[model samples]
Target chain A: MDQTILDTLHDVIVVGSGCTGAMAAQTLLESGMKVLMLDGGMMDSKYKSLIPDTSYTDFRQKADDQYKILIGENLEGLNWGEVSTGAQLTPPRKFITDQVEIFLPLESNNFHPMESLALGGLGGAWGLGSCIYSPPELEKAGLNANKMHEAYRVVSDRIGISASNDDASPYTSGGFNYFLPELEIDSNAKSLYDKYKKKRNDLNRDGFFMGKPALALLTEDKGERKKCSYNDMDFYSDKDKSAYRPWITIEEMKTKYKNSFIYLGEKLVKEFSEENNFTTVTCIDMMDNSVKTYSCIKLVLASGVLGTARIVMRSVKSENVKFPILTNPYCYIPCIQPGMLGKSADQRRSDFAQLSLFHDPDKTNADVAMASIYSYHSLMLFRIIREAPLNFKDGRKMMRWLLPAMTIMGIHLPQQASEGKYLKMMKDENSPTGDKLFAEYSLNEEEKLSRKIREKKFLHAMRKLNCFAIKKIDPGFGSSIHYAGTLPFNDNEAEFTLNPSGRLNKFKNIFVADGSGFKYLPAKGLTFSLMANAHNVAKTVIEDARK
Target chain B: MNFAEENKYNSEAQILSNYLVGTQVDKKSLELYSGISKTTNHSMNESDLKIWNFLMKHPGFISSIDGALAFTNPKSSVRKKIFFMFAILECRPELSAKFMSSNFTGFYWVKFIWYGVHAVFTTIFGLFLLQWIKRF
Candidate 1:
């Protein structure tokens, strides 16, 4: 044990500065409760400085030093013909998982996990898809629907959302109060929308719903952040602040409540215990590898499922205990629009998904699968060229010939808790945290059949809309980057399970603020719902403390 | 890792670039490619130069060269190094427009037909060569 910092005892200490952690700190700070956030946040200073404030076309056409930013100083994103999680992440955004393995270690042969301890966690490179969860989805995820309804609006207002009320509204993008103007669809997506509109009735009868996406990207200028310039550099950088990163909120709260809120970075929290009427958090200062302790009235474990699970299990001295886990089964379908081929892509366009599609053949909306439609351009031509059957030189030419017509549709299906898929973390002396997590997830035959059947329906739906699905690549588990259900919410008290109010039933002042308690993982992007749940959890913590 | 090894890989990259572009080694484009390899901090495998020298003649074999190399030496894949070099060089401010314009060739319909036929032949040829090499 190193020195203990007995500074002014804080009221609330939130761990992790990602989407959920930021929201939890925001709600607590708003209510005048002083909050301190301990995080092992990382930022790619080398890559960050290299991000030039210019459009993709201009950079590709003018920047002589473009290779430094595109390929990375060390070929960090180098594709070795092996598709792993975080492989699609570009050079600039590589910091999201920069030192995650060294900081938070895990070993799994089947499950390839993508965990982020970056400043904004994994959400720094978020696609900005802001979908409001239905009441049924909230219930299934073990969240209070009534509470989430208000938190959804609160989260929507805090991090601005822009969505249009259209055909996919009832299932995907409706029921939110705070709104910005909808983003314009790209030409490739525009043609798909036109085709969808013509056959709306027949398509609706078949359970394929299409509409404009609800993205967190700003469509209109909001305060200091400018509206999206459509520079088509959504993946490379967010210098213009058009897209909302959770760090933006954390930064704002830092200034507004400077005295009340404190963000201590480089703190890898290990475990917590309720001692002497104070929740004491023991963490390792990664800077000097010194064990440090901080005491607060309440502690919020918002370091995501992987991080939070390790801490709770370690705190309780549990080892190799099987815990249920859930992740969205994901697939990427490359399709072609014959009409858009042999033409130049629009000079001003962003890589954000322009269209949203949901397929629920039974129309029950219970097991609905979702897909986001994006027009490919800025990721450059190397990826397609290597995958094509032709030689390198000819493949390059064939790709450019097929460039304008290409539309990549990433599909995701809802995940359920099964005996087959569970995670277990054990004590390890060699590990940095003295604990190692191992995940085992295998899709059952019925689950595989369900996914295949739903994907075929979605493929058919795309074909009807004039886009032909050429090939579908199943990127395997954890590719969707959606991890949840490790520490679930149950009404009864247990060692690892959490209560509805977000409390770890074994401890007094500890709350699992992130998606670890999500009993079910929705097919849609879970960032928005994670923020809402964190806000609701913070409020419940405040309420419980008052009582 | 050593100065000699770095220089050797850089020289090999220059040869691969010239062969792929089918043009005289433009010093500036070659320099750009060399600079990127240096920045990538990539240590070319001992087998890489040999593999590049071997594959330079078979342009149609570029697609299978990575699989073939991986079969022999798990670390020696020419796909990423060569394609990445080609990708950045093609994106050069001075040459991107020219290459892009070529893709929209006026006789694209003829080229599309040619691409299909060429693809079939390349697949057959590359697989045959890959199997032959894998035996060793």
Candidate 2:
């Protein structure tokens, strides 16, 4: 058959069904462009049909393949000789454990890595804790807080977040006013707030009060999405409320833009055309191994941190690329006090409720940069301990008694290091997972110290909160789930960046909106930030095209 | 109704299954079938004992010699596993209902089922015991 060519190539093709991708697709389609979205994984209709009364778990009985954990599992020792060498080339199906070998080398070998492979990517399974990047994070990206806030307002409005705060400024101006009725703080949490609020005031530090952060969950009726019934379970299966998963927006985007199309369970993109002004994408469908091709005037790669980085390294065979890379290292601390934790898996409190710890550069010493602290739900805490195979046998017993365990994630922005810190693409023969992932990364002396110092601080905080037990992680026991930066956007680097509009500098049609274009170090979970960045990039692409 | 009360009112078939599970009446048979001398790890928890006792005292007693022999067979792993799990239900049916009916009921029930299945699948004799239990 002659190569098929249509009169209208899509204005843009958004790759990956992650939050960033969905946001880009929604924004672009709403702007009157022909958009096509291609998810590298399957579709999740559980939350998709929430308001419409469709249940995601109508028939699910156990934690089967679909409910697998959201992390990569190299399983080197577990899968030796059972599978062929090529199997390691792809991501694992189960939520990855720390035992799996990572592609990146460590500085002193410290980092806890976790990433997912489902259609919505990490956002699908992430603790639905939505905190807009503090002002410092915006400045790190070379953008002011106002611009970032504008983009967040746009995103928050579409997703229908339910939140309230005494101090939400200019960012929440547009979208903040309207949302589901403010979630009522439970009496116990309220009492804890009163107890801590006075003590926090005494410390004179910005004491965070217990209130629901503006979440993309519905409390009022919306199309096909029922308002939340206060069932505070945030992670895993959200059988009730429609929280901020990308698939929800994608459904709306698909309806608004009739020209838009989506393909799920499709194979990963194997090749793409970025030669002239147009880009052609080619892939081998995993379902049947059949080759499929998609062409668009512009292509956006949003396959997330590791996935996007790997794709770029494989697709662009050119060695002449200019951009600095940063790897984020994380630490977890659990705080438990008698009676602080109530029943197990009860729907008494929201899991994603906590304030983020961001580094105030102005207040910090010159040597150290700012950092962001995040909280995890009890269920996630249980999963983290369960991942350690050593305690797998007694996980149930531990679950019975352990009170509030708080996980503090400290994102250490890796400084530039030539020795092994820079993320480089490498193909290896003997990866334990039987596949070859782009391997490159090593922490520097500063990062190594940063890891220890932050872990210690978090540990001390836990102790102050009356925690009984504490455990520090050693090197090789860590890996970051949120991977960002291998492709930094600099106006000067034509060969590396997509120029001013987030397009590949050389290829006018190819663009990237995910974490790939970010250069900020110690990046907080950049999902919302990247969505804003995509909004700006999409606006630029359309405006420039008109010119 | 409570598992005990429910077991009393339950049909003879379900009662026998519950009693067999609650008392672990087939412990000797399971020990013989597995051929492994184990004490603590393989032994039934308190919950399992409750289920076995319920099964033995169930409304429909296994009166026939054949039925009795089948129930006592040590080789039936699936049947044994099911009875063992049912035994747990008998012990703490009230707590189980409480867990399942709570606000986050869906998540807890899902977790309860998952842990239960994981334990059952790990045992070598579980599948056979389940088959036997289902047959009766």
Candidate 3:
């Protein structure tokens, strides 16, 4: 732990162990580079065994007891009801890091962006909705399509995606390889697919496209992870390693290249500085209140969009900078198939979003909207019932009876940067949590119009599938949980932009490997592309080191 | 009381009994009921008398049924009170059948059968598949 040994031991220092950071660290380790990864979160070893595997009825009986044991009494009052429907609820591990430190403007109150300081970052709570950027989408994001394909193949081979090239291929821009068989769709999803297949020609003419969504879930057992047991506990429990989490990669690095990789938990990196040929990183040890500095040949900041932006702004000693922040406008619409009402029990495995419906309404514009179909039982029915028009008591009774009949169609609309949408860094010198970050985002007139059009088109498609009683709930901004574009990459190295290789223009040794370096936030989920970009950046760092 | 008056009371009692069994009392209704009860000094109104009589007759079913409903309606005072009602009569199979028939459908029974068969096959075959993959 001495300074001399630390300086001699590690070549690259990576902040965060989420999807991007872990992939970067693994790639670097494989290329004979020693890495020191610092994370503010600690992994809970007893999580899997501690979670009970009982029937839902029995589980509900012990709900209070389980909550007390799992999340503790300290977080009993946390408003979980506020986040009704999203990818996943904040896990118990995020209790410490889920603090609301940002100051939101009046206009941005609905914009709630969740960040996780868990060992795997937000990837721990991710719905595993993995989609590769189409060639056009990649070009829009200012990335080389050929290089991205190479990176995508590398990522797909490691993560193992469950997908098949189908009708939605044109939208996904299919060419990349898939490693696992597509998951079997549930009866409800099968009904929708059958209808879509029957009316394929008509639907295609109406600009509607449907296919199985690419998911980062394993169909067969791989490594230490087991295949999905279809136990329907994906959102709350991690008992089955069938779903790919970033921790798996971190664990692989630790086991395979133990000598080359070292993970230091409970260390939150605040800022970094470049001196001569080495970068000095200052981090606070959360366990004890001590500040420590680590020096490395190169620094990679994959602490996520907001986390990385805070560190960069603090390093530059800036109070407020107009940085463009992008997010996909998200909404979930419920469609009821009355025939399927009160039919299926909630015990069966309801995978996240079995079918993805893609729509490109206009050929002139690159804008696209995607809707993923989810079974009713996949999410907590209590949350969905609250959105019902009935009173609380009546709603509960009705929801219980109608639970098996509902299907949620989640729509993600592509959002582009405008003059009003930007993040401002607050100057808080005395606080130990670093500077507070505030964002102000408003959709342009055109984007607002586009959203209305997309909703109408989606409802039409739902009606075509014999779904009735359609209700849409737009969760508003930041609910997408797909945030990017803080320190965007520019080929021209524009003011306050990262270079094409993810290295900052001013700092020679610093590299950003997360969504912060994205030039555009596409409608699809960002994790798959984030991992691919991280791999590309790691390769660039290795090649640069050789030079 | 006259025979006509007695017939009217019985008819009202029948309607209230159906309401107690079918409808879940929401928080707002419970609050209104509480206010009315306070103003009337807990004197049994026709509606209240019928509800109380129903609870007394189905004492064994009242607590469990009310308890489940009250848990889902935590904020309702009437539901909370009814949940702890004392039991005297044994729960009847006929009453249970009525509840099930009212709440469920033919589709539910068919789907449950399908799921049961599917679950059994997956459990057995999944284990075999894992073992075969491990051997490879």
What TM-score does the A-chain of candidate 2 achieve?
0.74
lDDT of 1 by residue, B1-136 (tens): 5788567656666656654565454565566566656666455564565556567655445655643443344344465577667766665666566344233657887987786676666566666776665454
**What TM-score would each prediction reach against the true structure?**
0.92, 0.65, 0.78
The C-alpha stretches of model 1 lying farther than 4 A from their native spots are A1-6, B1-7, B24-52, B56-76, B98-106, B122-136
Any runs in candidate 3 off by more than 4 Å, and if so which? A2-9, A44-47, A53-110, A172-175, A362-365, B1-103, B106-136
**Model 1, residue A545: displacement in angstroms?**
2.4
In angstroms, give how far residue A450 of model 2 lies from its true place.
Answer: 2.5
**In candidate 1, how many Å is residue A150 off?**
0.7
**Colliding residue pairs in candidate 3:** none
Write one digit per residue (lDDT tens) for candidate 2, span B1-136.
3556433323333343333333322332232222211211334555444434444554232222112323344222323333332322222322222112223333644664564454434332433543455455
Q: Which tens-of-lDDT digit does each residue in A22-44 have in candidate 3?
A: 89998999899989999866565
Q: Cα lDDT of all candidates, in order?
A: 0.79, 0.47, 0.67
True contacts kept of each: 0.31, 0.00, 0.03
Model 1 C-alpha lDDT per residue in residues A1-547, reported as the tens digit of each score: 1132346578999999999999999999999998889988788798677778888888888887666676665545556566667667888898888778787878777788788878989888788888877777788989898888888889888788888888887665654547787888887788889999999888889898999888898888889999999988888888988898989988999999988988888899998888867988989888888888898999999998888888887788764688888999988888999977776677688888889998767876666789999988888776555555455655665777777789999998999898889888866787778778888889899998988888888988888888998778877798888889988998888878999889988778889889988998989888899998999999988997788
In terms of lDDT, which candidate is stronger, 1 or 2? 1
